[model samples]
Target: MTDTLIKLAVQAQFRTRPTLRSVVAQMLTEHLQEKYPPLTLPVAQLRLALPREGGGRGLSPLVEVALDYLASGIFPDLTARDGLDAYLSDASGTRLSFEQNGTRHYDLAVVEALIRELPVIVQVGFQDALMAYWNMPSDAGGSRWQWFAGILQDQLRAAAIRQLAGDVPALQRINQLTDYPARETRSQRHGPESSLHAYSVQTRLVQGETQVTVQSSDLLLVDGKQVWLCNLSGRIEAYASLDAFGQALGSAHGRPVYRRQPHLATL
Candidate 1:
């Protein structure tokens, strides 16, 4: 049986299947649980200390002595208050709002400020993920997959930091990546101009239900007659002709022994 491969540019982030945000949250949660076991803290209390929540421990007489000092240090714009809860309430009330295309958007600078106060572990995780990601060359094969994976790793790192700062027993974030679609860049190749036009190519063989897919990122012009396909997370494959590339792809995917239609540019 032969396989099929399709390639196309998605308006959303690359790799639309398997949500990246879910993957990221999963990684971070796993990391945290590994480091800190036996989750027992109440969910509400955990929310108070998380980075996105501003690392506020909520109301407690024991926290009052340090409330003024901490609130002033964390929320400089906040005024002095008689109690910790009052101070947190005042800080929470402070918000930044803006309108875009008649749509209202709120910026939680105060919440982000708390993220900055996360412990060193979270900070280190973020830094490491970033370093690994940035180190990868954009032109390399599978870089796009790496890019998506890296972004998730970074997000997880950030979440982990929030979890640590909040003293949360566990991380709880949903993967809503599918909500965002892949976008086209100015230099993105498409249609006849694109060497590989399908966002994802799939072919099936006659004998079985197995399908073959080629995550062609871009086409590299080796010469006037030769071209190379940069796969998503694989090595570059050289094709003597576009027709040959299609045939090979079909064969790989278990396509029948026949002249395969080329999945390439019009040229």
Candidate 2:
């Protein structure tokens, strides 16, 4: 079947689906596994050696506040405790009692309202979030991060949609992508320091199913499109494609794919 190709924005972080509801569903599904009704604030659990005297304290400065936000049905996909603004209880207890601030006075009614709305809000939010991914480049042929693009497929797509179908009408959209995966540039660097690992994805869409696949190779991107494949692990086997990348990952014992950042041991 003929495939459609589209160029994506350079800075696009995600590909969005056609509808706003889909975006909301994706966001909620992404957060559902998070610790809800959090008993403690994020990063609240800190360990400190007891002073020679007698001092052991838990609960960070933001603990109660964070808890309040959780109670508010805020987004759970957040990475930090400081992000607990809406869900955690505000300090003024305006969320609890006499409303000095816009926060509802702390009352079971307020808490109950949040609890009642949590699932619905999250579902809609996540559906919208998934739609955002489509806004990114779905054209496998042009995708430099083709491997990751391939994983953004229908099984996962349907799974994401199914999550919302339980509560909201399923979002329906037509998505199509086409791409090519050839080393844009061949490796020229010879020394040990000249090495990198990269991946590619190639896809074709058929009527009933989306055929997505991924590949990997060692390389570094240059000048936007040039690729320099490398031999990092001291072997020619380093030049692996998608199928080989999977095989190497499954068979290897120590590490499959290791991308380390500054101060990160193994990210």
Candidate 1 Cα deviation (angstroms), residue 238: 1.7
- Candidate 2 lDDT over residue span 1-267, tens digit each: 111221234233344334433333333223322423232322222111111212322222232222344456452221223322222333322121233455342233333344345455655555544544444454445433453545433333344343434433112210111122222322232223323323332222223444433333332222222222223221222223444434443453565343221110110
* Candidate 2 residue runs with Cα over 4 Å from true position: 1-9, 12-106, 112-124, 132-246, 254-267
Q: After superposition, how far is residue 164 of candidate 2 from its true place, in Å?
A: 42
lDDT of 2: 0.31
RMSD of each: 22.5, 20.3
- Among the numbered candidates, top lDDT falls to 1
| lDDT measured at residue 219 in model 1 versus the true structure, 0 to 100 | 31
| Candidate 1 C-alpha lDDT tens digits along 163-266 | 33453322211111111212232114222342222223433334345444343444332234554554443334556875666667666445445433334432
